[model samples]
Target: MPRFDITIVGELNLDLILYGLPESLPPERELLASRLTLTLGSSSAILAHNLAVLGSGVGFLSRIGDDALGEISLAKLAESGADVSKVRRARGSTTGLTVILARPESRHILTYPGAMFEMGFEDLDLRYLADARHFHVSSFYLHRALRHRLPEVFARMKAAGLTTSLDTNDDPDDRWDGELDQTLPSVDVLLLNAHEATRTARAANLEEALEKLSKRTPVLVVKTGAEGAIARRGREEYRTRPRAVETVDAVGAGDSFDAGFLHQFLRGADLERCIAFGSLAGAFSTTRPGGTEAFRDRAHFEEFFSHHSTAEADALPSPKPAPLQAKP
Candidate 1:
């Protein structure tokens, strides 16, 4: 067996969430938040942590500063049972961090890319990467230093006989400029939200976006929030509706979905089952405050899984691709 089920090459950071903030912040004013929370953050880190919690042997590869914040980030990630042996500590740079001002309806995030921007293709150890059965990368836009080298990295991973996935997350610049054409072909699976899918494809709608992207990526998965998620492979497509739950926060739902999807996928589960488990995991994430909170232990994960997953759902054979239906 491979040493690890999955190896994640991505960023590591912390999220400082301040709740009950004013809708608008005026410059040069002191404001108080009714609540504050500091938790492990970054799309990649969340994915690795939650995946490890879900019983996957996960390994994380990234760079962080040799600072207190970095120490905290590393400790939190290690606490989640993910292998942090490949994580490097850069001497001069500090770890990345995001400050979130949580409003009633929406949240504003301020990010400092710090050492997250310092990692590059050179920092990646191919020997370490070879130990995993699959590879995943996230937050494409945030990795400034490694942006240009991703295609080569993906190619290397593919050459090492590893299935690969990419979650570009949100492009802060809104200019989805990268080696997507070269990179997508190497990517076995590509995960995106509805907005990201449309933006990356430059299409008018989600269906059109999937149609275009599916041509490049072998499998395309789109996270549609409460509507659940949809996936396409070749001409085949599958979708799963989200489960109803009392949502605490939607911070890392998408990453959690990725973890769920990949968890079943690594087990050789079909796409339909993967989508269902992915949706179930995404919903479970919102029942708690942070990404990995709900799956903090095996008991929580098993209890939630047992309560939410039906035997029929798990045993159902993969269904035929349904007719293309546009999002309403």
Candidate 2:
């Protein structure tokens, strides 16, 4: 049996969010606002942390800098009950940080790539990562040094008989084509937002993007905030609307949705159940200040999940017949 239900390989960092900031930032002027929070950030870390909190056996692998920021980020992830034994520390460079100036209806995010961009393929423990039932990666564009070899990583995982997923959060460059075409073929599930889907597929619109991407992976999940999420599996399609909640911040809502969706998926739930749960998780994330702050509260998450999650059997899906392997 695999040692973990899911193993994640990606970036780890902290998000510094400040609320009550003016919408416009005039250069050369010192602007002060109210409210601040520093919490676990980065799509990979956020998803891993929330997934662990949702009772999955999660193993995380990443490289951080040898610094206090790395320590804090690592500790935060660990607090969520994930196994971070494979995380490494690069020398010299500082760990990455994101500064978010959040307003009532808008936000400006500034990021420093830091040590995250320096992590190379050599930092990975292939055996450790393969000792899992599933493998996942996030923030494709942010993985500068490792992007070129991600396809190889996914191929190896697939070869080892593990399912895989990728959530290419966003392309800062907006090019949306960095080994992505190579990586898609190995992906069992592709999770992204509506905007990301359109941008990635380069389709004229959402409907066209879904049609294009669905052919690339066995499952394609597109998260639409407020309206909920949609999923596609071959000819079948499923959609779910989010439950109403008093929102605090939406920093990690999408990642939370991934955690929820994948959690149900690993349980072998149907796509409808997965989408419903995913929407619940996304809504729950907004009740707290940062992406992970709400999840850090065990009581809060347990209660929220109990109320939203449907009562269902927890059975592993029957295994599919193995694909024919090429002669070695």
lDDT of 2 by residue, 1-328 (tens): 7888889999999999999888888999989989999999999999999888877878999999999999999999999889999999888978999998989888888999898899899999999999888899999999999999999999999999988999999899999987999998899999999999999999999999999999888999999988899999988999888889999888989999998888877766678877877888889999998888888887887677666545422321122312222111
Query: Tens digits of per-residue lDDT for model 1 on 1-328?
Result: 6688889999999988888878888999998898887888899999999888777788899999999999999999999889999999999989989888877688888999999888988889988887778889999888888888888888888898888999999999899977767788779999999999999999999989989998988889999998999998899999889989888788889999998898878767778877888888889888876676777755766777777657425522122212222110
Error of 2 at 159 (Å): 0.4
Name the lDDT of candidate 1: 0.85
lDDT of 2 at 275: 81
**Highest-scoring model, TM-score:** 2
Candidate 2 overall Cα lDDT vs. reference? 0.87
